[model samples]
Target: MKTEEHKMKKERWEKDMMLEHRRIEMEEQRLQWEQEQEIMFCDVTTMDDDQRAYVLAKRAKIAKAMSASVGETASGESGV
Candidate 1:
């Protein structure tokens, strides 16, 4: 039927529009992430040796604490 054909076309058009929007959003997010990484690199590059070492140590400590918290949560959930 003509109506069915028209409906199919509309659905296809909508799907294509959604895909294009998602692609654009992903590209924008990727650009933002790259910019953030560039800024972080610049900050570290400008840091003196002691400051860089302190930052690295703090990052490691935070990572370790987060890992421990995640492990605890996982174990607790499994027990439930």
Candidate 2:
């Protein structure tokens, strides 16, 4: 026994929930990919400075894309 106005409001709420559900689903998928990638790469913290430097130099582009801001601290940590 819903009024016409109430029916329209219900429909709008349903549509909004549907769109929000889709956005959350997409974000979950992206996070899964990131976790998988992290597992595939070697752990740099355990490597010596020289080895870390070599790996860092070769992977500079990947770091850049990940928004890494290189500086003095990085130099100390990455020296090979």
Q: Using lDDT as the measure, which candidate wins?
A: 1
lDDT of 1 by residue, 9-71 (tens): 999999999999999999997996675455445466678999888767766665676578688
Instruction: Estimate TM-scores for all models.
Output: 0.54, 0.48
User: Candidate 2 residues 1-80, lDDT tens each?
Assistant: 46988999999999999999999988997996676466448688998999888767656655654444355446565421
Clashing pairs in 1: none
lDDT of 2 at 59: 67
Give candidate 2 regions above 4 Å deviation.
Answer: 43-80
RMSD of 2: 11.1
TM-score leader: 1
User: Among all windows of ten consecutive residues in candidate 2, which has the lowest summed lDDT?
Assistant: 71-80
lDDT of each: 0.75, 0.72
Instruction: Give the lowest summed-lDDT range of ten residues in model 1.
Output: 35-44
